[model samples]
Target: MLNYEGIAASKGYAIANAYKLVHPNLSFSTMKIGNPSKQVKRLNNAIKRAVNDLNKIEEVVITNMGSASSEIFKLQATFISSPNFINEVSSVIIDSKVNAETAVSEILERRISKLKNAGNGKFVLDKIKDIDDIRKRLLAYLLNKNMSDLALIQSPVIVVSEDLTPNDIIQLSNKNVKGVIADLGTNTSHSAILTKSLNIPSIFGLNNISKNVSNDDLIIVNGMSGEVIVNPSNELVKEYSLKITKYNQTEKPLDKLKKRNAFTKDGKKIGINANISSPKEVNLIKNYMIDGIGLYRTEYLYIDSYSLPTEDEQFNVYKNILSSMNNKPVVIRTLDIGGDKQVPYLDNNDSSERNPFLGNRSIRFSLSKTIIFRTQIRALLRASIYGNLSIMFPMISELNEWYKVKKIINEEKRKLDDGGIAYKNPKLGIMVEVPSVAIMADQFAKNVDFMSIGTNDLIQYVMAADRGNPTVAALDNPLNPALLRMLERVVNVANAYKMDISLCGEMACNRYALPILIGMGFKNLSMNINSTLDVKALLSLLDYSLMQKMSEEIIKNACTVKDVIKIEQRFIKI
Candidate 1:
């Protein structure tokens, strides 16, 4: 038996035969085109067909995987129709006199090479897979060749691939595929996102997995532990089978706590809400027994569309989500696009910064394009009549940004009023993600109706470490004493002003962080849909008074994350 370790993306255990998916290398002879005009025409036709194919796939993905995952197809379709991409391919064919397939392959390779040479780092490296997927699909259409489809798998298998694109994962939905193991990918990759949404156990970043694993080899994919055992012994198989059964049994108890409130033994009720990207996810509220939505990521709407969504279109999506919530407070964050999450349609000249994270992003990007910002504000204002809605601005580092955003929102309200549009001004809030903002939390809390600490970015910026970078992942610790002190300050400011505050980052949902957060006086907590039930169950078993004492000791005595964790373990033992 051979054991391999990788990064665990989704949670589950699966034992099945391995099905190797090796992409065939296409060999083509370069031939001068007899007629450039005809070649260009053929290229255009191929692109059109690819766009049409992607559109069909988009609908299927939306129905099966939700709008967030469906965005991958929409993005690919946009790239296919992009004038820059089309013109580049046409130029290659006309200038080099090469066939459509060769021209596309050459141009895509050149573009990918340029992206790498520019030192764009991991973000651009991940995008290379998407471009490669497009190249394969287009070339297949031009070559009149058939590409392997996961939907055609005849039996249950653990899919082994060099890299599974978003489209590949989507096609595996409802198929006999039980798990996924890939040679290259990260937790933030699109393939990982799709697998999690589809509930398929997955592991990534296993180097040379495709070379070592053969077809029909019995494999055990332990996604929770990031372990892959190839041709396991009977003893190991039996052990894993028992572990799977126990894991499932443990999870079943969480369902019983779904109807129960998240209250400590001493009777302190903490609101447990969800963080969602689309309206389709609102259906999970009842199933998870969520109090409300803590964070409604509005960036996906912008990133997924070919153009900016019209006010009415945006209004309808927000209204549907709010109405479905049935009076539960839904905090709608305005378009947080920029930095790593860029939209081609919204691209301006200022996007070529060396460090996009510190450059124009979130509120800075929105304020620069007031027209786009106002349109979203108008939509949220129109949707406010449906349920309890709150507006939040991301990446607010100073007071002026908040004042400017509020001014524009008021201006949008006046425009609506003049047009006789019925709307209400929802509660306004700002995300305390920057250290500068956390330092001024007291002043900012008094101005905004509420505050939500985005611990993900907060820790990243506070520690000067990029969370996505593996080398610095350890530095971006939420349990770090410095981070704890920052949160302590923000919470104290919010409490001092009696403003409602909630922590809406990954930390809020983490079981280990729950006692510290509740002890710090965070009455509202929000996390991913899957974590809600377990967190609620954990909360029910804790005593708030004891957590408060531990929290005090943690903030006062602990000078490092390890010390804080040690304190938490001691409290848990009690």
Candidate 2:
């Protein structure tokens, strides 16, 4: 038996034969186009063929995985229509008189150049692997002239791959898919989140599972421990089965608390909110008495696309969430990209920086992509008609940036009015992530609807620690006194303005931070859906007034994580 360690993405246990997915060999060579007209025609023909293959893949996905998973084919379509991508490939293909695969390689090289210039060479390169895989599949389709057998399954499959794109992850049908293990992925990756949502076992960044493990090998995967047992004996399987049962049995109790309130023993109300990326998650809006969505990220619709989503597409997504809330407030935070999140369509060449977190990203990128920003505003405004929709601009530091956002929003409103589209005024807000913004929260509260503290970014920013960096992962402490003080300031300012204040970050989900947040006057606690009931139960068992009294000490003296935990333990006991 072989064992390896990786980050546990989704929790579960499973024993199944590994189904390893092999990627096609990628090749690239640049071509110089002598005739623009001829090159254009060739490029168009190639794209058409690629689209036809994607249609076949879509049909295959629908037949094999179900329609819900087939929505990912849209990503393949976007790749086919990439303007910079198409132009670059056409230039190389026509100039060099090479095969499409070689042309794609040259195009990839060009993308590497662009990525390097954008200052996130490694991040962009990782993302480009997905693009290249699509190109290779398209090449295979062209060579074979048939994708009919694409749905053929090899079953009782434990799907293993180097990684999974959001598009590929959906094509999985739970009927035959026992579990999934990958060589690369993060908690926020589409595959990881989807697996968690589906209650499947998943482990990521497991270095060499593909090379070490052969096909049809019986493997026992323990997601909680990030371990995969190769060729497990019957005894281990039986042991794991019991473990799974016990885990489920424990969780069976939390289900009943879903509908209940999160009021503490002293009757202090704790509002629960959910973090979301797509409008499809709107189904979760009324599952309980959720205060609202804390973070409705809009990046999913923009990233992996050749062109920005149409205004109608953006509006439909926003409107659905708005309509589903049924008078419940929804806070939609504008695009948060960079670090790991990237958009293929943006032609950013300034890649000289080291830390993308501190680079020209988030609101800075939003300002750069004016068309995208304007289109998003138009959709948010249209969706506002459905219910109470509050718009929050992310990564705000300087006050001037907020003014600029307000200016653009006003322009979008004017355009909507001119076009006779009905829209209610949305409560404008800002995400207090930067320390500067947190310190100046009182000033911002006067200009916006409410202040939503995004402690995840705030913690990273204040500590100068990259949360994704394993070397400094221990230093990524949201419990740091600096971050706590900022949260206190934000909550105080919001309360002074009679504005709603909430925390929607990884920190909000922390059992230790719960009392501190409640103590600091934060009414709403937005977190992952799975943790909602547990937090509610904990809240119901605690005394918020005591924590409120101790909030001052928690923020003033607590500099390390140990200090923060000690404070919470004492407050909770009281």
Candidate 3:
């Protein structure tokens, strides 16, 4: 048996025969170009067709996965339609006197080389793969070469590829594809996001696994531990089979707790809510017996459409989700755009920035575009009358930004009042994502009605590490002493002022972190809908008093994530 380690993108296990997908080499000798204008027209037509294909793919992806994952295809569609990329190809064709395919290949290669040599971080370097995928599709269309048809695979098998794009994952979803093992991709890649949503076992960044495994070799993909076993012995296969059986048996009982309230042994009732992206996820809320919607990401309404969603459109979506929740409190976060998530229509002049995460995004972007910001605020205020609703602003680092946002919201309300429109005043809040806001939580708590700790960005910004980059994923841990201290401070401020505080990050979903969070006095936790039952069941079994004592010790003694893990293990054993 050969064992290889990779980055675990999804959690599961799969044993199946390998099916390799190799890209055919499309090499053509330089042909004497007859008419440059004709070649340019052909290239433009091919680009149009590629854009249409991407749009269709985007619709399918949005239906299968959420809009957040579908952003990958939307981005590709925008990149192909960009003026810079199109102009580069046209210039190369006219100047080099080569065919459209040759011109595209040459320009893409040059652009890829330039980007790689720029020495940007891994987040920027990953875009190279996206550009390359676009090149492959455009070239295939121009040359009339057949692309890989994943639907043709009739039998179940694990897909092994050098690199798989979002388009590839969508195509493979229709087949009997059991799992995926790729040579290149990070846990935050589009391919990884799709597999996680589809509940497929997947491992990526395995470095040339396609070259080692034969076409029909028996393979075991252990996505939980990021291990891929090739040609495993019969004994090892039997061992894994028993392990899978045990896991299924344990998971079956957790489903029974879906309808139960999550309360500690001491009778402290904890609110278990879900973080949703779109209205379609409301069905999961009812199915999981969630308390409410803690974080309703509004960026999808802006990102997925060709233009901004009208106030009526946005109001209908928010109203439907609130009505579905039966008056449960739904916290709707304003549009968190810019940074990695960009909308082509929102910004006309697109330019690459050295550091986008720290740049225009979240509240800053919304505030800059007051007209757009007001429309969403109006819709949110209008929707408040439907059911329980709360409005929250993201990425509020300073007190001034919060004031600016409040000013606009108040203005929108005044407009509604002057027009004799009926609306309710929902609770207002700010996300404590930036370290500055966490440090000044006492002052912020005095102004806002509530605070939701966004641990995902808090850990990333606190540690100065990019969460989406695999190289720095290890440092982006919430258990880090600095991050915990920040959270502690925020919680203390919230308690002193009698303000409502909840943690709405991926950390809340972690089994080990749950005790510390509850111990830190967080009464509300929001996570994915699929995790609500398991987390609720786990919370009910723990003693709140003991967890609080242990968490205090952990915060005082633990300095590193490793130290925190050791402390958590000791408590678990008790």
Best by lDDT: 1
Q: What is the lDDT of residue 535 in candidate 2?
A: 84
Give lDDT tens digits, candidate 1, residues 123-233.
242255567778998888787665665655668899999887435665777447889998876544445655765668888878788999998999999988899999999
- Model 3 residue 188 distance off true place after TM-score fit, in angstroms: 6.9
* TM-score against truth, every candidate: 0.81, 0.78, 0.77
| Ranking of all predicted structures according to lDDT, beginning with the best and ending with the worst | 1, 3, 2
lDDT of 2: 0.72
Tell me the spans in candidate 3 whose CA falls farther than 4 Å from its real position: 17-177, 180-197, 204-219, 230-235, 348-351
**lDDT by residue for model 3 over 1-574, one digit each (tens)?**
8998988877778888998987766776776596889999989998998888777766755665557446666788888889998999999889888899998888888867766565322224225556777889888888877555454466879899988754566566543778899987655554675576566888987888999998889999998889999999999899888877886788789888888889987799999988876677787568777789999889867655534678898989988887888899999999987555666556522266667788888898888888788989999998889899999999999999988988998999999999988899999999998999998888998899999998877888898987556566678666787788789889989999999999987788667888889999999998767667678877877889988888898899998888888988877652
- Which residue ranges in model 1 land beyond 4 Å of their true spot? 1-9, 16-63, 66-136, 144-198, 202-219, 228-231, 348-351
Instruction: Give per-residue lDDT, candidate 2, residue 125.
Output: 25
Task: Compare the candidates by TM-score and give the number of the best one.
Answer: 1
Q: What is the C-alpha lDDT of each candidate?
A: 0.81, 0.72, 0.80
Name the candidate, 2 or 3, with the larger lDDT value: 3
Alpha-carbon shift of residue 482 in model 2 (angstroms) = 3.6
RMSD of 2: 6.8
Q: What's the CA error at residue 440 for candidate 2, in Å?
A: 1.9
